[model samples]
Target chain A: MNQNKNALLLLTGISLFMAACGTSKTGLITIQEQGSFAVGGKVIASPGTFDPYKPTPAGQTFHGDHAYVFYQIPPKARKYPLVMWHGIGQFSKTWETTPDGREGYQNIFLRRGFGVYVLDQPRRGNAGRSTAAGTINPTPDEQQWFGTFRVGIWPNYFEGVQFARDTATLNQYFRSMVPNVGPIDIGVTTDAAAALFQKIGPGVLVTHSHSGGMGWLTAIKNQNVKGIVAYEPGSGFLFPEGEVPAPIEMAGGQMAAVGVPMSQFMQLTKIPIIIYYGDFIPEKPSDNPGTDGWRARMVMARLWRDAVNRHGGDVTVVHLPEVGLKGNTHFPFSDLNNLQVADLMSKFLKDKKLD
Target chain B: MNQNKNALLLLTGISLFMAACGTSKTGLITIQEQGSFAVGGKVIASPGTFDPYKPTPAGQTFHGDHAYVFYQIPPKARKYPLVMWHGIGQFSKTWETTPDGREGYQNIFLRRGFGVYVLDQPRRGNAGRSTAAGTINPTPDEQQWFGTFRVGIWPNYFEGVQFARDTATLNQYFRSMVPNVGPIDIGVTTDAAAALFQKIGPGVLVTHSHSGGMGWLTAIKNQNVKGIVAYEPGSGFLFPEGEVPAPIEMAGGQMAAVGVPMSQFMQLTKIPIIIYYGDFIPEKPSDNPGTDGWRARMVMARLWRDAVNRHGGDVTVVHLPEVGLKGNTHFPFSDLNNLQVADLMSKFLKDKKLD
Candidate 1:
């Protein structure tokens, strides 16, 4: 009986260990709340008597030009949520699960006890209703995007690209790209972002690619933006009105800095900002439009960085390859090594005392 | 020492119990696979020399008219995955978490060990690029949708409506509506859905509102459709060419049953099918267009049921009010009592042995 009791105890101990291990691995996320809402849309009323029973007459009103925000707050969340805004032709899905089924930044940040707010900018993705009309030409633009996104030329991966190279992953990646329902209006998008900041109140703004430029303007428009973490702001670098940098000529087009008032530009200087760029961007100008475009952007980024630092603002630009984290594509956050990249971000947050 | 050992063993046993309980409550979901892909889009190449280095000239090719599908499969999933397609002005968001933040049918069915495939039909939502050009006029049509959706007239909820009445919920609901980036082409949408079935293999097709008609056509188009569970198929009731019913007139316009060949119509008879209609749909046609429109639809649905039954098909139509489940809006799957609605679906699946 004594031996049997000892064996039972040992079994219980083993069971407890396994149970605890399993719980940690598969523990349910205790969510404080998760919901979605819209911001910055207007109602355009038409000149006719609206009737539900009949076909909508020419005078019916329209409610559009809005941005949509989906948010999830975990229990014991940090002080501020990370507001994730996607780039051109993308939606909140960019921050959700990656095309390869890996955890995206939304889940990654949520696991680290920070609330996450993913946005669909006006006239894009879920916010498809627009006040302005634009033609969505069924144009074969995947290869164009592939080159632009630095995923490498079609049919070939850049030697050390961090993106998943499997056919399934590639299929999903291409499928994720969506077209804008209306014309791309930077002002409307910026207004929506500012409105989101106003509604959510005091949050870190995270922007990718095309939205990077809008992020700067949003910070200037709203004081609620505590900080900004941008990944490859492809365009829309702003400077105080007479200080705009000379345009960097690219194979596609000329990349120029937009000029904002000195006061609005100074609002960006009030916040700590960090920028991240992935691999394959050459130090010098190259004939390959894909790499060269980014090279120009990086050069502009440094100029912007210097300008901010000169004004007593904190700014840091990280080239992943230079930091020993190589082979990252434009989308470093969704790359396979995203967890490592996230750690780098966490360190920055800690150093800046934002966490 | 023996006393201490007994105490330790008891503590271990208690700890094991707690861990097991915690795991059951909050265990992390082990996903077998999750990814997305597009199906059935034609590539329309413009007539010109394509140049990557220059502006997209007139000759650039466009990939449009495709449906985008996001799928998540759980380990040990049921035999057939649930293919969820949304209705007018909506996307896969309809099946995701609801406006009120409740687990939508996607997660609900996923938790029940069923793989879920959420689709964005061609020219709509995520699949916004289209071959045909259409206008998205910014229209204030939320009131029209509210009435048509049976949530009640503007600013008024049907007494005991199943929809969440909070302003936040209302805001989210209105924001969820997306305009078609191009024309609303049912043929194109049906073709894409058929292609999705062909790609994914045998699965149960679940559709809501507008897609309900397309679901029936999809079943006829592809043999991979194992079953169908539709919620409020507002239009596109199919009948044998010779037996097409006269169009039902409504305050809005006329509701018509599309005609298909008898051979194609017979395909629906091969699968087990079920339909659910929510509350506020009156039994008799009334002057109130909102209720009357649905009353006409319900009447048409019964006629459809008779037609299917006449041809030896398995079809069941459940009016929630008649079955003691009351106060449901058009979207019963995302209602406050969605779990109950899910239970009814589960029962049907069991009866049909599709699970």
Candidate 2:
């Protein structure tokens, strides 16, 4: 009887271990709710009697200039959800699975018990309808984007870049670039983003690349943006009306700061802000325009940070290489080291009491 | 000793049962491989010395007219994957999830151990860059689509329509409409689709609404298309030379069939084809153009079916309401009763030995 009891105990232990293994392999996530909605668009009605039958474009109405938001809330979620906005030539897919088939920030944050809401800003991605007219010329500019995105110089990988170097992976990365159906209007986009904040209530705003400037404008427009996490903000840096800095000249073009009222600029100082930059940016200007352009952006970023901090604002700029985290591209959140990056983000959220 | 053995068995059984329940709740799916790629785009080089710095569109090259495909394969996937193409004014999101947050065809089919590939055809959705120029006017057209999609007449729901009647659900449904970055060119889209088939190799093609015509054209272009499943094909029906039917006049516009050589038309007869139409299509012309337009399409569909059958092809057309599944809209696969619709599709797949 004693031997049998010992055997039973061992058997139970083994069975429990097997069950635990099964759970990890499946990686099952429990989602309490998930859905999507649109906000902040105007309806344009054509002048004339509308006819359902024999309808013509001249006598039709259109609903556009709206932002679309898709959300998934885990059960018993945290106090605030993370609202993710994409950069130029991208949509919500930037926050989804990466080109290499790895989990993106959307699932990463959700797995950590925080709700994730992704947006397709007006005139791009799912929000492809626009009020303004713009032409999309079929220009072979992937090489330019490839260099600009810091994945690497065209046809060559930067030493120790975080992106997958396989042809298939590159194919996906290039294919992900989309075009705007209409000309990009900063005012229109910010208005739509401000509306998104109003609809979602208080939440942390996450912005990338071209959307960095829009984040500040949106936060100023609405008080619901409790915090901000910006990744490689390339343009649209805002300064007080009289304190705007001189334009930084680059090989491709010039980067100039936008000016807003001191009252509006002060709103940014009310929130905790964090900005992250990736690897390969030279400390000084380089001969290559692709690498040198990022160098200028970094200089501008520090200036932006100083401006915000002078006003008693909470701002922290992290250069991944400076912190010993290396090989990251412009898209650090979706790179191979995304999980480690996510952990760093989580720590900041906890420290700021934003999570 | 006997009592101890019995207790051990009970404990093991309970633990195993608990593990199974956990698996169901988490809905853990094991993905073997997943990624995306682009196919069939041409490179247009501009004349001049290309300058990386001070880049101008006049001295740049552009790549457009490509189809983007995102794919995932499950462990031990079925023999042939399903390549899903969306309709006009939409993208790959049509297959990801419904507006009401239910599983769309992508996940539904993925769960059944089949590989799934969703596409963003050239100049639409993710493949937004276009070789042709077009204007995207901000026209208020949601009500037009609302009625045309058979969800219901504007501001009302068709009796027992298989759509969520809540405001939020309706908001998402309307917001899903997108505009084309360029004019819709059948030749360009079909060429890109043919390239996708060549890359994927030996798969079933699934087309919805505006893409229904493209599916037939794609199959004719590539022998890799093993079968086709079309949902409410609006236009681009092909008949043999000298056998084109007279254009069907509708209140909104006219529906015309294209003429192709007998040799190319015969290619469609080599594979099995199935078509599905939803509710609210009148048997005869009605005063309401929205409903009447579909009636004309249905008539064309039968004519197309008869033509194919005459050429010794196997084709099946299913009207949901006629078969006791009522109140379906244009998007039956993503409707509230999507699971039931999936099962119906599965039955057809198995019967035709295409599973």
* Candidate 1 chain B worst ten-residue window by lDDT: B21-30
lDDT accuracy of residue B332 in candidate 2: 92
Clash-forming residue pairs, model 2: A54-B251, A61-B139, A61-B140, A62-B139, A62-B140, A63-B140, A139-B62, A140-B61, A140-B62, A140-B63
Q: Tens digit of lDDT per residue, candidate 2, span B306-334?
A: 99899999888999888888989999998
Per-residue lDDT tens digits of candidate 1, residues A1-355? 9999999999999766654332132333334455466788766766766565553644445667789787767655798789999988888778877878787887778768788999989999778878887766656677667777888865468888889889667666766777888888988999999999898899899999999999998998899999899999889898889889999987667789988888888888888899999999988777778778899999899999998888788889999999999888889999889988888888877777777
- What's each prediction's TM-score? 0.86, 0.85
Which candidate tops TM-score? Answer: 1
Instruction: Give me the candidate number with maximum lDDT.
Output: 2
Q: What are the lDDT figures for the candidates, one per model?
A: 0.82, 0.82
